[model samples]
Target chain A: MQKSRDYAEWYSRYIDDELSAEEKQAFLKYLDENPQEKAIVQRLQSLQQNLAQLPPTDTSEGFETVLRTRIQIEKKIGYGAIHTFFQRWRMPFLGFATALVVFLVFSGLKGIRWDGMPTDETAVNHASMQNSLSLPASNINYTLDQFIASPSYSTDAASIHYQPAEDETMNKNQGVVVDSTGKIKQETTKTIPENLQLSY
Target chain B: MEGREEQSKGKKPSDEELIARFQQGDIYAFDLIVKRYKQQLLNFVFRFLNNRELAEDVVQETFLRVYRKRHAYKQVAKFSTWIYTIAGNLSRTELRRRKRRKLFSLSDIGMEEKDYEIASDEFNPEKYTNTVMHEKIIQREINKLSSKFREVILLRDVQGLAYEEIAEIVNVPLGTVKSRVNRARLRLQEQLKKSL
Candidate 1:
């Protein structure tokens, strides 16, 4: 029992030299009784001795100076850069701007019409005339009634049939008579051949 | 009256206090902490890595981490334990990195032998050859140790940290720390005995 307690106490005190005298005596007696335990203690003591003999590592000279400089630089740069970058642009604003730019880019790629394309007013007027000519005489009455209701349509019936061509000769040669309903009616003169078909 | 006496005695401010002051912009206090622990930290790293320059870098990195994390420090454990934990983590990372780089690069295969030769050449010629040889043997034995056991032995035997402190640093139980240290010391002694 004494030997067991002695060994346990020695094991605890082996880490530091705070062992009391009685504890040391008891441990010695325990070691004498237990050869295996004695061997273990000896090994531990040698290990301690070797650890103590280890040379002190040197860390002087420019090491501290360099370390301090690095730390200061890291602190200054790390916090400030993140803060400055994030502070300048809120995430939502940046995301919105990015989305807008991407949308413009893709839309441009797909050839969305811009406001600057030339308008063919003459072509549009010709297309409208063609559409009116293609309609049946009954639909023409309804369309005419709607067009007259609009303030932009003129009230003169003769003016509606007479669209002045750019060339005066072409208009006379064509001599195409269009009714109020915009159906082109050919008028035959005795001088002109009956089989002659004129088309505009 | 007791408080006044305690103040009059002026017990050194604990590591946590010093760290708090450091976080509050007391650079001198930090400097004192560094001065106090740099050698031990360097020694710990040097033994673990077996490379002086790498050890120095690890020590610097450890201190930098500690300083950066100063604000998060609680006084739950000793400051030494915290600092050691940082060192251990950094050293382990460095070791892993080195292993990975070595596996990929394969350029420095013979560098350790060359370094050993260089180290031997730099030693004193006349008086301390045996001591130097003994140190080299010990260094080789330490290198042979598994990293976990090596760390335990280093923390306990070389650094003189308590088992509890080591447990905190290693994030293990006190019993584990003691057992690991004991096993590592035994292994080291066995190796030394065989060499002798």
Candidate 2:
């Protein structure tokens, strides 16, 4: 019975002439042993041929004229230009858009950690990390690499100690002396301002 | 001869070439495309919807889409497959709309009824009855087929499209198309056996 069913598939192939010449011979030999199967193949062939011959209907009248008119209207309004563009590109666009939305949703969820009051341990960790890091608004998205490399980063608990410098000491004891006493410099002692001059 | 030159020029531009021309905005090429596939699409849609009027509407819409979306067509597939896909989709949509209205245009209304009415009036009425009844039986069996089987059979047998093309048109794997076609042919025979 299983064998007969396998041969049944060949019936369509035989009818469609898809079988190789050798398979055609094999199918014929098999059919000769099976009259009922042979009859069925003959009938299927008849049916298919009848269907093939079934009159192909032509466009009623002025199908082109009507379609042309509709096309002219379509051109005028140019509707479905966007619709057709979307229709043609529907799948790829949908796929990209879906990926984008999903990514944004997930990323947005991840980004929202700093926005709301911390409710969960992860959010709390993020909040503490943000405050402890004192991340500047400009560098809000400071990454791990940046964190490690930042000047504020220290193994010891060293907080920032910013201090203003004095302007007086910032200026140099302006000139170079060859020795403590023998100052055959560029004869610039007269040119030196009192505060900037080196004391002999 | 000028006619020969026109024929050579005509060398029958392939459907691809015609559409290529149409894509280049040759209105004449567009006219040729409409003329070429119009009837074939009509018959396919007509069989699919089993409604002459609606089938024409669907075919018209199919062409309108081809015209509007001419630039969207790529050479990756045959133009016939592309157009048939359009017609087939419209036909299926119309089929769903038809089901909503609970209207099946089988023998209760169809081409067979109108075919004999026109042919018999012009020719022998007696002969027309027998032939028409036979065709009516076949058509009814065709209508009895599930939409899945019906579409495949129509594409494979009636329209004489390649299995690959049918597969593309129906968006099924080639193996599935082969089996569906085989089973559909058998089912059609089994049904026609009883009635015919």
Candidate 3:
């Protein structure tokens, strides 16, 4: 009793108004020619109507009131949870936070030593540079004099000889010079430990 | 005052506009959004879930989420899709919960596999009278459908959402959504014809 193939597809689209105007006209013409197919369209329409007419279920009265109260309660519970969190862990959190802040500030104010505190050589170099920059030239000279006057100052400049490395040897003559310097370095090594001890 | 004038002039703002206002912390706008969606969501959820109480609970939870997550709504998305997605997810969760409960109850009672399908407290035939028998039949057929099919039909035909919106709410490809809706409708049509 119903049309077949493309007409059937058109029937579905026709009901939904999804068919093109030309398709709709052709479909209507097919329906007019086959009156029995009208029942099919009617059936589909009735189904759509029935579905739309299916009893709408509304929330009971005071729905908003109940919902509002519930939202309020939920908000309160949420607020309470956060409040309790702060209340319960206030001191510990404060302590941890304070400790973290203090650590950060201290680390910021004091220089960051990549390998912990500076070694004696670096500290001495830093102190000397700071004194040289900050003090008057006369004061720096006086400080240098006091530093040299110390018993820790090693005055033997020849003992601090630079030995030409093996690769740096000019010739066999250079080897003789390096041999003598090596002896001088060996002799000064014993006295250098005493100077380091006094300097520390 | 301008909004009031527009309301008096018979032009209503769109859902997106209302949601945008709500996002700006307008309490009245929030109330309007809730009022607008309450009944529609109730109907959608009631059909999805066959119980009034459960449907109402889900709607309540849906609204609760809307209130709680108002800021999560992006202006790029339709408010309807966002709210429907929330309701659909809640409905799916309730269905899953019911399924687990049914399984546990069936095991507890040592029931056979056949009775397991009919073991829900919701299947009271007494409530489906002669007057509403057709509606009851339709509801029963819908309930008999798989969740995916049922949800697609409900969203498409019952709620009259566009296929694109349904796809967005269900989080499926557009082609998949269209096919599911067509298949669901065909299946429902067959059942409806037989019942008639």
The model with the greatest lDDT is 2
Clash totals, every prediction: 0, 0, 0
What TM-score does the A-chain of candidate 3 achieve? Answer: 0.34
DockQ for every prediction shown: 0.26, 0.38, 0.23
Highest-DockQ candidate: 2
TM-scores for all candidates: the values are: 0.58, 0.62, 0.58
Q: In angstroms, what RMSD does candidate 2 have relative to the true structure?
A: 17.8
- Report the error of model 2 at residue B193, Å: 0.8
Which model, 1 or 3, shows the larger lDDT?
Answer: 3
* Pairs in clash, predicted candidate 2: none
In model 1, residue pairs whose N, Cα or C atoms come closer than 3 Å (at least 3 residues apart or on different chains), thus clashing, are: none
Candidate 1 chain B least-lDDT 10 residues: B124-133
True contacts kept of each: 0.49, 0.80, 0.40
lDDT of 1 at A47: 64
CAPRI tier for the interface of model 3 = acceptable
The root-mean-square deviation over C-alpha atoms between each candidate and the true structure, in angstroms, is 16.8, 17.8, 15.4
lDDT of 3 by residue, B77-110 (tens): 8889999999999999999998888777846454
Across all models, the iRMS values in order are: 4.3, 3.3, 4.5
The CAPRI category of model 1 is acceptable
Off by over 4 Å in 3: A1-11, A25-41, A79-200, B1-11, B107-133
